[model samples]
Target chain A: MTDSFSGQEKSNAWSIKRRLTILYVVSAFGILLISTVFLYWVLTTRLAKEDGQFLAAKINLLREILAEAPNNKEVLQEEVEWETAPFRLAKYYARILDSRGRVLIETGKMDTVAPSYIFPRPARLGQTPSHAAMRKSTNGHSLLVMTALARVGDSRGQTRILQLALDISHEDELISDYRSRLLLVLLAGILLSAGVGVFVAGRGLKPIEKITRTVQHISAHQLHRRLGQSDWPLELNELAGAFDGMLDRLEDSFNRLTQFSADLAHELRTPINNLIGETEVALSRERVVEDYREVLESSLEEYSRLSHVIESLLFLARAESSEARIEKKLFDPRKEIEDVIEFYEAMAEERGVTVTYRKASAAAGSGFVNADPTFFRQALSNLISNALRYTRQGGKIEIGVEWGTDGGLNISVADNGMGIEPEHLGRIFDRFYRADSSRSENKPGSGLGLAIVKSIMQLHHGSASVKSEPGKGTKVTLSFPD
Target chain B: MRILIVEDESKAAAYLKKGLSENGFVVDTSSEGDGGLALMEKNEYALVILDVMLPGRDGWDILSEIRRRGIATPVLFLTAKDSVQDRVKGLDLGADDYLVKPFAFSELLARVRTVLRRGPVRQPDILNIADLEIDLLRHRAARQGTKLDLTPKEFSLLALLARRCGEVVSRALIADQVWGMNFDSDTNVVDVAVRRLRRKVDDPFEKKLIQTVRGVGYMIEND
Candidate 1:
């Protein structure tokens, strides 16, 4: 029904300016029509009252003369007839009748122009007979005819009928002229309303247009730009703030992505340069079998490093994607961490780092995790090796499980190794972020060890945090939800 | 033993053929999926090494076809997708085993041997390698009746390499089978453990049983 009522897309989907203008015009038109009709009615009523009173007054005067002096001809001709009178009433007719219905006096041509039959019958002999009517004269003039009975002042003590008529064709012409002028005023009012509506609506929606222009200028390269909310009204503040917040988040992620790609290229280039340079040098001249064997082994090592980087990259990518499927199972986290400690035992022993697992004295019981066992172990292994890498001889590493503040489980690995510098503490978990880059150049990590651990924790809907005191120890915790 | 490797990359197929031939298996190679399926149809082989992404009719189709025809040749899927879903899908389609690509050739060799050795494997309680005796039931080892002192994990590592006897076992396999560490780590944990085991198991004897196959893995072989 709304579609049919609208009739067309342009009207139904009118712009705010057009819609407001049309509404203004329609309301103005309605008000003008009603008031114009009311004024016309009031005017019509007043004119009719005046005409009736004029005829009554003339009859009353004529009645007076007939009773006091029935033969007063000059007075009747001047006042009652109004034919040659100097009054502003240009056209009128009067007639008098005797008690037995005989025409006593009448203005010349009163019978021809307004016959007696056209007037209402006079009231029966006593009451002042009063009636007024509109009729076309015999000569095509509009007339208002009225009749009344008046008692004479003479000794006869009889009642006589008096008839009078007035022409109103000039008044009708004046009313029609008033109506056409009113119509012109009404049309002008509607147009002015539409104009005012357009101006007002445009002023109200100017801010939204400004917003569109600002938004159009922003691209991926200009994500840092924001729709500052301070200039907007209260109603638009929320929209502006939300837009700025989205841009903030977008800019942050885009920066991280850009940094990640650069890091990836650098990490990959390191090993490829080595492989190419070493292979090219080896093939520059013939070498002994042992030399060739050594070169090939070195190339194989580079290949393994390249493969490891790819593997870690893939794992990080998969863990970040929402669709990376992790098959969770219920298991004791303490037991899982213990297995990784055992796995890293021999390596730690060679470095004289005693790695062990123990329940935190503050812990209530063995805490379990609904997590993928493979990912959990990998995370723990990375942390253990990171600890082992920095630990000096006789350094100690401890793995502990305890209840978190929020009733979840917290698994921590604390090592009395070389603690990290305070400045590098924050970004240790970023991919390819190395703390002591030159020192860790020949280290066992792929530079993604901690990043992978962080990714794994994220996949479990958990968090990983680190606290370190240089020269004392460093502690890394994985907090899992209850 | 006989095996067929269906792979698209020419270098991968050639190296796989070389490695399997060196391991004493009569190996055949095909670069297309349909051709590999036809080869298996006309010939009887002990096992099929199938690569998942092929030019025509992929590895899954070929494996399903081989199984549909009632041929009992065990198939091991070799593909690059390491997702759990793809692994389950391959196994669900009658693949005997699954090995992800960029695989250590030794791991492939180990899987191939396992697939061909279908059905039950019966072994005596003891495995003898020269004078060294490993008692699988007791979790003890001795050379010429002198019991070697070893930790439980060390004993298990010995048992894993001993089970494969003369075969070269990759470090990843050793880590997984012995310590249950499935992810790749750049640490020398496995190598360190092997060295510790060799100190007790091989250093005092005139003959060494354990050997490091340089950047590949470890093996305990006696001549």
Candidate 2:
């Protein structure tokens, strides 16, 4: 009754729902983190590219002006210092160097912030002069610096080196502002995802928890409780169905055991009570030796009957038990049938009941069964005797071996006498079940004959069934698998 | 012949002693394992009936000890355990035979006789119970010098009862010995067979040789 786990028990630190939630959170966080980092990289790369193009445009403007007026240093300086908007994308610093790397013309603050030597090497002439590098100035200002070869003198004359710098401190502050905002969003996303993961996982596993609660409330006496098969999901429906199937088998076995015990006690109480009463009365006075002998003999007979019941019960138990090892060999069913018939021939002749054995002409195969010969004999013997008991004088009892429709061998014993009533036929194979108890009292049997027959059939992995018509006859057939 | 019974249950030991004594055996009973062993050491018995479950010095230990001392006395085990493993264990320990408890007295007696009659069976060609004679070799039965017509099964049945002439043979034993059916078939088949045999072997004469012992079994004797 203690429904303890049969194997090694596992001690888990976390519940299944918790584990599912953690798995969901970890995988989701991984995907979100990758995308967030990629977004930041794209934004920063775009801002840097724009700054480089802006520096290139400023270098091109210097190239155009110097080509028209070669010594106009003031004009180049004024062009570098001019700003149309009060709030620019970035502040620019430009310096023009001659062929000897001398500063011919420069912005006022260009030397202090750029210090000319910190610029990139000039590009080839007639090129776009793009691709600037970013550097931090000595005074803690962020700058984009670039150099290019520009034509000076008339229409692409001498080449001049133009160094330009863009102060990106304002852009850096804007990108930093975006980075912190993104961090806040990521943190919020993590918290939101974990919360949703917990909810979703709990919702998905709610059925399993319901099953556990139902199972926990079910003890031995509460076997009637069931996990209703309809409410479960598709995957768990199979599990629930199987569990209910097992419960059905268990309940059936439990009911049978209860009925069997009650019947056994009732059956045993009669003979035992008779023995006690018979002995007590016999010893009531100084009885004669003959009387005492008769009582003792009767008591021994009672004991023998009780002993037979016990033996039959044990045989039934052993056959049904998992450890019952039946030794099977390939043997002809005809031979065992012959032997059983021979044993019953005397009884048959005594009753004037004609018993016949036949092998149906339509039967196929060699008619040999791979089964325990003793059990076969016992099964045939019980069936034959039962047939003989039911048959009247001048009646016919026929036994035959034939191939059933499904290819299994069928051994049936049919009699032409008073048949059983239909209402009593359903439980005919139950232990100690007699249709007409009053009539069976006159006859001799422990009423376990058919039960033993049924048990033996089960051990052979076969089945026993009965077909009877109230006034016609009863035919019991045993089917063995092919 | 002498026999020693070591059984802790007093009622079982007492009835066994009485039965064996009545059957003309010099029986000795012991309620303890050590006492039984001491008796076995002091007395030379033809057979020892030992119960496997005892108060002290289990029957197996006593048996092994006796065999260890090189004693060749036959030992028959009586126990409530009817499992095949237990039976094989008893035999493997050199016991002569085994019988489960709640056993019929006739079965125990028959087993005891068979155990005592070990080593080269004595098959008599002809058995005489007063005027009835059973020819074992020829498979024939005759009374008053007239041949009794019986089938082979009937002949074997008569022979079995004649061989164990005066002792009561149980119905289960008869069914097993004759039909090779080992279960206690709760039926009157044995009674019917015996009745048919009685018609052929006993009905014709004034004296009945095959006698039913009334709820026990059959025995062939001139009584």
Candidate 3:
């Protein structure tokens, strides 16, 4: 358990559960300690006051009895009888002295063990009663002593010093017992709070544990599974949402990768099958010299097809992986577009399609852009070729260059021919996606034209977009950053 | 037999023309889909060999267009796309057969024969005239009950002429059917092959069954 706890600490210094439990226990302990101390103090002060009151009350009763006496002798007799009374079960001692320090009256209880030093000496008249020091009697009983000045006889000018002592051993025992019991209750309360802290902390962190379990069950193949966000706490809900968002992106990329492989397999299979079928059939029969020559020529065609596919695939791979380098240079956009148009003019004329170039009036002034001329021209060439392929005889294809509203360059190719449907426009830039498979079947295209164009724009930190209406026309735009 | 080849690739089209011509069929070639479609609409053909990828129009569109016009011409799809879906689509679009590109001349010729044999204008099982008998199914040719040892091309050449015994088949037609060549190459390949074929089929027999109409073509006739 220690090993596991240390490992967990390495990951997160203290887990939430442990931290919460510690916080709860520490706070509870602090509050419990303060209250226990307060209660103990109140109890001790009240007990001490009660003990002092009891001693004072006893002294007042003795003074009253002395005042009612007719003479000093009777007072002495009364004091002696009071000390020996059956109601006075507690240990007690008392004495009365005249102004000259001569003992006037004394309790018989003091004859065996009297604490003379505990009585105040030379007490001032009319002084408030004061507690004297504690003393032990001969029987080893602890006592509290008090002293006061009083008038014991009927004479107004006469004063006496009164000293009293009471046994307090039993009260001390009760207070000690209460103190020990209070301390035990305080300790038990702290321990119970710690136990409660752990339980509350565990309940509070249950959502995190649930999230961890759900996350643990997710693997690459099960990326589609999402963490439950509904029943979680607010903070944990946000975490689950973020995690689910990440999975969404992961699953999207995974699906794209799978689709790419399937498309690649299909694209590669055609040429391979052609090569196999052709060679197998050729070798099946013994043919004349001219027939053998024809077979080799056909085989070379299939080989070229294979090489073309590989080259295109390699270029795509490099571009997608960011391994393809772009050498940007300041050049005239108009000249580049014209050069591309010139290159495709022959093929366009062969198809009886007219190609034209247009420039916005503002673009003619400063139409230069910093870009890789070769790749830029290639991107334009792909668009032009696509337009030419879709355009019909006598159809007009226009290439236009202009300054975009965002201070960038926008080069567009528009053709008045068969336009793409809106549904296909979104995926037109995806690799191996063709707008119309039936129409593209006859065209000599690898179906990577738009994808390559998109990649080129990406390498140049630009974007490509298309707008078209079926049977009307199609326009493709390439935007470059300023 | 007269066949139409609609292929966008010039070289492949030339090869197909040569191979079909040398096999004793008259072959017409078009490098674009629209041109092939126009040609097919103007004339009747025994078979139409179409490349799926074309410039102006595609093979599927052309096939559908012809089929829509109630033209029951058998179409054979010749393409570089050999995917099962592509093949299935071609067949679904009323194509009689499908052959991928970079194909052997012999295989194309055989498929062309198979298509032609199944055509509406069927030929007899055995073409017989002037004691010369050609077995179309067995690919065998014999004169007067004596078996003839002939190469495949030679036998095809004999069978072609014997089928049209009294008609003049042009050199262009023979070249297109036998060698699958679209344009005449400046060589005596066809003449040389024919001379060798005549040596085995005619030179061995008393009466000559092969004769050349000067500047026109060759024919087998009982004179």
Model 1 regions more than 4 Å off: A1-205, A234-239, A361-363
RMSD of each: 9.3, 5.0, 24.2
- Top candidate on DockQ is 2
List TM-score per model, in order: 0.72, 0.80, 0.43
Worst 10 residues of 3 chain A by lDDT: A80-89
Per-residue lDDT for A359-465 in model 1, tens only? 87644455677789998899899999899988899999999888888877788999998898999998899988888878755656788999999999998898999
Name every residue pair that clashes in candidate 2. Answer: none
User: Which candidate should be chosen as best, given TM-score against the real structure?
Assistant: 2
Off by over 4 Å in 3: A1-201, A218-224, A227-229, A236-239, A328-332, A360-370, A401-408, A439-443, B1-223
lDDT scores in order: 0.84, 0.84, 0.75
Residue pairs clashing in model 1 are A67-A152, A67-A153
Clashes of each: 2, 0, 21
* Candidate 2 lDDT over residue span A88-161, tens digit each: 66777877888679987777767777898788777778786558888887688998888888887775356788
lDDT of 3 by residue, B60-160 (tens): 89989989889889999987764556888999999999986645454466577767767388568998877888899999888999989987777877887
